[model samples]
Target: MKLLFNLLAFTALIFTTAANADISENSLAPQKEANFAQNYLDRFMQRDFDYVMSLIDTEVAGTISPEKLEEMHGYLPSGKLLSTELIGSQVKVINDNWEGSFTFEYHFEDGWALASAYMIRTEGKISIAGFSVYNTPDSQKELNRFSLSNKPLGHYLVLTMAIIFPVFILVTLVTCIRTPVQKRKWLWILFILFSVGAIKLNWTTGAYHIKLFSFQLFGGGAVSASEHAPLILTAGFPLGAIIFWFKRRSLIGQKKKTQKSQTELKESDNSV
Candidate 1:
C-alpha cells in the first residue's frame, strides 16, 4: 500500500513540473516578440542584408528592388555605432499573424543621433512589412531642430555679417587705392586684388547661400554657410575686420607719440 502511494505522489510531481515549465514559456513569449523586433534592427545595422531580406514578406519584397532595399534600410549613416536603444514598440494581430512597429534610437560615431522605425509582420517569427526610407518623421524633427529657421539670433547675425563683410572689403580696397604714397599704394592695390580674387573664388565654390527674405547671397537657392567654401568666406570677413581695426588703432597711436616727441625735441633745441 505504501509503494502504491509513493508512485501516485511521483506522478503528481512530474505533472506539476510540466505545468510550471509551460507557464514559464508562455510568460516569455511576449518578451520574445519584442526581442525579435530589436534583433531585426541590429541585423539591419550590421548590414546583414541577406538575413534581412529573408525576413521580409515575399509580397513586400517583390515590389522593391534588392539594391533599393539595401539603400533604404542599411547603415547609410557612416561611422561606428556608438549605442542603440529601443524607445518603443507596438504589436497587433492581423489575420493570425503579428504586425509590429518598433522605434530604435542610434547614436553614431559622428555624434549624430537618429531614430529609425521598423514595420514588420510575424508568422511565428518577425518579417519586414515596410520601413521608412529617407526623411522619416523622427529624422525631420531632428533636422528642424538644427535648422536655421529655429535659431533666430544666429540666423540674423549670420545675415548681418554676410552683408557687412563685402562692404568692409570694398572700403579697405578704396582706402588702399586712394593713399598718396606711390609704392605703398601700388603694393596695397596688388594685395587687395589678390585677396578679393581669392575671396570671390571661395564664395563661388563654397556654395554658401545667404538668404534673407527674397535676397540670396554667396550660395544660391539652398546652400548653408557651413559648407567649406562658404564657411571660409563667412569667417574670413569678420575676422579680418577685427584684426585690421586693432592694427590700425595701434599704428595711429604710435604716429601720434612720434609726432609729440618730435615737437618737444624741436622746442627744446630752440630753447638751447
Candidate 2:
C-alpha cells in the first residue's frame, strides 16, 4: 500500500507539471527590450521623431514618413511627462520569433494616456512593430451600462431575449427532469441543455449580430474578456429544450408500452 501511494503521488506530480508548462505567463520584457521601449517612449515624448523612426523595423520605417509620425504623436495627451508606469506586458514566442506588447500609462501634468508598444524579435534582432496612444480609457465602465436610450430595435430585442431566455431554459430543464421518461432519459437531458441559434449584442456599442448555425452550451449568457472589456450578451433559441417538451408525452407513451409488454410476457410465462 505504501508503494501504491508513492506511485499515485508521482503520477499526480507529473500531471501537474505538464499542466503548468502549457500556461502562458504575462512576464516582464527582456532587459534589452525594456530599455529599448523606454528609450523610444522618451524620444517620442521629447518629439524626437528621427530617433524613433530609426528604432522601427526597416519595412515599417519605409511606410512611415516624418510628417506622418509627427501627426500620430500629436494625438498623445499634451503636457509635461510627470511619470511613467508599466501597466502590463506579455509576450508570445513562436519558434524563433517573439511577439509581444507592452502597455504603459504615461502621466502628464494635464492628463494621462495609455501608450502601447508592439515589438517583434527574429534571428536575435528586436525592433518596434507598432505603437498606439489612447488619451481616453478604452473601458466598458466609461460607457453606459443598462440604459436603453437611442439603441437600435434589434439591440433592444436581443437584450430582452438575453434577459429572459435563460429563465425559460431552466424552467424547461426542471420540467424535463420531472417528466416520466424511462429509457435514455439522460440523452434527452443532454439534448435539452444546448441552444441551437444565437443572436449577439454588444453591450457598449449596442451593435448586434445574428448566427443561424451557432450552438451555445447552457443557453444564453454574457461574457467579457476583462472587467474593463465590454460585456457581450448572447441569446440563442432553446430549440432542443422546446423539442424535448414537445415529444415528452410520446416518450412517456413509449415507456408505458414497454412496461405493458413486459407484464404480458411475465403473465404468459406463469402458465408454463
Question: 100, model 2: CA deviation in Å?
Answer: 2.1
Q: For model 1, what is the error of residue 132's alpha carbon versus the real structure, in angstroms, after optimal superposition?
A: 3.0
- Cα deviation of 265 in candidate 1 (Å)? 99
TM-score of 1: 0.36
Backbone clash pairs in model 1 (N, Cα, C under 3 Å; residues 3+ apart or in different chains), count: 3
Span of ten consecutive residues with least summed lDDT in model 1: 220-229
- Write model 2 residue lDDT over 36-86, tens digit each, in one string: 677787788788987888778877777878888788777777678787866
Model 1 score (lDDT): 0.47
**What would the per-residue lDDT of candidate 1 be over residues 41-148, giving only the tens digit for each residue?**
677667677877777777788865668767775435667877665544556776886666655556666544444445554456556776553322233224333233
State every prediction's TM-score relative to the real structure. 0.36, 0.74
Whole-model alpha-carbon lDDT for candidate 2? 0.71
lDDT (0 to 1) per candidate: 0.47, 0.71
